[model samples]
Target chain A: MFWSVTQSLLGGLLTTFQIFLFTLLFALPLGLILAFGSMTRFKPLRCLVQVLVWIIRGTPLMLQLIIIFYGPGLWLGHNIWSGNEAGRITATVVAFSINYACYFSVIFRGGIEGVPAGQREAGQVLGMTKSQIFFKVTLLQMVKRVVPPMSNEIITLVKDTSLARIIAAYELTFAGYSFMKSNGLTWPLFYTGVFYLLFVGILTLLFNHIERRLDYFR
Target chain B: MAILEVNDISKNFGSTTVLHKVSFSLEEGSALAIIGSSGSGKTTLLRCLNFLERPDNGSIVVRGETLFDASMPFKEQEKGLRTKRLHFGMVFQSFNLFPQYTALENVTLAEGLLAKEREDYKQNKKTICEQIEKHGRELLDQMGLADRMTHYPHQLSGGQQQRVAIARALALKPDILCFDEPTSALDPELTGEVLKVIRGLAEQRTTMIIVTHEMAFARDVSDKLIFMDDGVIVEQGDPKQVIDHPREERTRQFLTRYAQG
Candidate 1:
């Protein structure tokens, strides 16, 4: 009986992992582009990006998931996401990507701007173009500066994947909660915590390793 | 003909003029040292040559090509100025080596970019890389940093970082090299290491313009020296003549303090 319960949780963990992986793959680069947009000298672009980031960051992720999943269908008189399991998962991923991208953009903008202007000027005097200066001299230092904060957000994201349960997307927590209602097995609901703890523990190790690799800056 | 020429170049930051019609010329292999009190426009003049600080008026001619003309639109001049800057290498007071790059990488990164700009380099990419690597190693070796080639900037001393910066600048083989208070950031003992490398370059007759406070070193190393005060050149001529026999009251007052020290 215990074996079956563990097996079911592991299956749900796969979906959780999928959401986590896809969100990062999309969000990291999207965040960098948004960061550049926010820092542009062009006035309209800079203001538009800042306002968009502000709205996405101000709202709760769970509320965003609900609205993103159901709002389009209700407003347009058609189920844009098709009212299926795939549709529910797609909505969850879209909401997570948009939400995390905004947060990561703030972290990235801070990192990029925090680098000293002298470094960029040095690249300039070396006859490097502006883009070359950014990629060659500034990008590595920016990454080093942003890592600690970025890791905090990433670890939080692992736990927040359980919020996918709000939309009835079958992630790890949703699977565990279902066990409590059907078989009255409260153990699985608590057992889900172990999986989250293990995931976070591994992520902590990974981030620590990254920090060491970037230790040359100091 | 001179290797580099700045004709009546003037720079203004807001309403205040910093460099007022500053005109100077550098011979092919002569070293020119610019001396001045703080905020005397010494550093600003150096920056203007590299186009780091654009001059509001006057023209800059490098190797017979006019890079900047006050009469021209900035958009047209900026595109030309960037390409012209390749002929001049600038060393800063802060030793702005890319912190993430190793000593060798810092020296070679710009070399690779410069090579990419050459149409010939496209057909000979392997040869270009090999040449860059060989020349970069030679420059570091010349700076006495061969063993520390792989070391990052943070691991090096202020002197060592400045020396690496010198090697990086030299890797491009610029027609003229400009130094802006290169030893100001170093300790007294550390300053010697950087000064020694510069002395070697001077001995080899590398064309250089150094803005410095090392009065004795400037007297010994420079062929031509200019003393600047309050946005204008107060005195200029042979380094020893200007240092020993000042013609202007401001230049005499400035040199006496160095003499007393």
Candidate 2:
């Protein structure tokens, strides 16, 4: 009985990990693009991106997941996502990526702007083109500045993955809760906390390693 | 021939004019020092020459080539602006080295990036990079930072950072190098080291335009000096002459204030 329960929770953990990985894969680059959009010199485009980011950030992630997963079926009279486990997971990932991307974009913008203006002026006087200056001078310094805040958001992302259970995506938390629903066993729910702890632990170690690598500068 | 010729460059922010019809010419292989009280537009003048700030009305002619003209269309003036900026190397009051890169990398980063534009960069990539590294090492050695080539900016002293900045500016072998109060940010002891580097460059006949408060150093190093007051040149001639005997009341008052301070 114990082995079977552990095996079941492991399957759920896999789904949780999948959601976490895919959200980052999509959101990291998306966040940088959004950051540039919000910072663009073109006023209209900047305003448009800022407004969109504001809306995404203002709403709750759980509400976004519900709307993305079920709203189309209710409002459009047709479900865009198929009635399957894969479809639910896909909807959950989409909502999570968009939500986290907005948060990350704000962090990225802060990091980029934190670099001293004199640094860019130095690049300009060195004969570097604007793009060259951004990539070589500004971008590297930005990465250093963003790491601490970025690590905070990423850890928060790990815990927020549990929100996917709201869409019936059988993630780790749901797997744990299912034991209480079926067998009237609550110990598995406690067991599921171990998986999240381990995941967050590994992430903490990885971020520490990255911070150490970047410590050569300042 | 004059290496740089500026005619009636003017700049205004909103309604207040920062510089009004500032004009000057720099001879080849000579150093010109600009000294003035704060807000006298000395830094702004240097910025206009390097294209960091646009002049509202004027022309900048370098090597007899018109680089900037107020009469030109905005788009036309912006065209080739980056390459034109290569004519003047700038060293800031703050030694604005890229903190992430090593001292040597800070010196070579620009040259390495510019090297990619060469048509032969692909076939000669290894050799070109080796040459760049060699030149970078030599420059660091010249800056007395041979052992600090691999040290990040945070690991170096202010004087060392400024020397690296000077080396970085010189890597492109600019026709004219501009220093905007290069030692203003350093302590008195550190100031001597940076000044020594500039003194060596001056002795080598490096054409330079310096904006500085080091009146004695300015007199010793610069061939010509300009005293600016209220966004205009108050008096300019030999550095020693301007320092010893000023013709304008504003220049004399400013010099006396600086002396007492």
Candidate 3:
């Protein structure tokens, strides 16, 4: 009776939150680089990146999870992902990073290419160097353009972290379900929904505020 | 001696020969207009001066530095060409103002980049800001965009955006400024606004090379006018001669078609 729901759920929520932060850390910069590479003028380089993004986007995420978790040992005959919670978390991170990065790159590329070629020429006319043009001019506008779509992916990410359970990672969903099976506390699994809702709600409101700020673009 | 020297600059886009045996020069702080029908290689020649398009065969000497000297070889001359371009600024038919930035950021970003490379790199940020604000405020104000400083390009009117474009080019304080049909995108009403700004800049003795079809505008503003046709300079001289007393038959035909009463 003393096993209160708040404490039990809080532990699982902590794990869920960690995955969200870590995924963003690795994915944002990686996605931008991939976007730039895909837009490269060099034909072979563009083709290579396009094929990679296509395969990453076309395949199912769950399949990616299974492969990322299990493929290394089978393919290389070495268990690079050690047998522990660390390995499970590592595998989940890799799978999540790759899947989200591919999605993020498309948003990034669209934002950048949407910037008019005229703007770049204008920057050159002002004597801005290539890097200055990108960071100061192109990238700033790109962020505004990409935000709404990026927010969509981010909110989806809040839900996607639950997918980590497939690899036997003791993330929020796993912890909640464990209560259901062992103690027959079905309430805990349903309780997990509250955690997800709060996260998504907060992120959605944050994005809405950003959109309001960018309303000046109107 | 001419402050600028160009010898045999030629360019082709893949198979289409856009410019052939094109060459020109200018005196320091002199206003020269390159007037031509569309696709007559006028814009491309101006682009060569700015390194926006590398010429296939030519040598352009600005001040004393050789820019785009393809005669020496491509690889050896690329760096020198890019360096020379830092001394000149250009505006295009389209305003090309960065849609994401405010008017001030657009100007400051350029100075921050190109100025840092000069010997006076470690100068005070306050002075830099003062210079930018002084020129940027005056230009945008003169172009009638003082109220729209923080506005994005999309938020501004077409005429206002072109004013921002002019402000950006002037911010660089380059040795010369080039305009490629700068008013073509504007409505007749809006065209007057941008042209008026250019006229004011020209009155201040701002060195300029303009490519335009506005015959009166070109004739009135140009110290020298060049009529380029079929990728060659058909005629050029004082504006009164080229615009009024044309020497070449082609120049007369061109001027007559658009000559205003």
* Every candidate's lDDT: 0.91, 0.93, 0.81
Error of 2 at B260 (Å): 0.5
**Fnat, one value per model:** 0.67, 0.90, 0.52
Model 2, runs deviating above 4 Å = none
Top candidate by TM-score: 2
Cα lDDT for residue B190, candidate 2:
96
Cα displacement (Å) at residue B2, model 2: 0.7
Per-residue error for B6 in candidate 2, Å, reads: 0.6
Among all windows of 10 consecutive residues in model 3 chain A, the one with the lowest summed lDDT is A1-10
How big an interface RMSD has model 2? 0.7
Candidate 3 lDDT by residue in tens digits, B39-147: 8999889887787787888788878777668877667775544456667888888877665568766555576666567665576756765776777777677777888
Ten consecutive residues with minimal summed lDDT in candidate 2 chain A?
A83-92
> Looking at candidate 3, what is the lDDT of residue B117?
74
Q: What is the TM-score of each candidate against the true structure?
A: 0.95, 0.98, 0.90
lDDT, candidate 1, A1-218, per-residue tens = 78988888998898899889989988999999999999999999999999999899989999999999989988998888867877887888889999999999999999999998889888988888889998888998999999999999999999889999998888999888889999998999889999999999999999999999999775
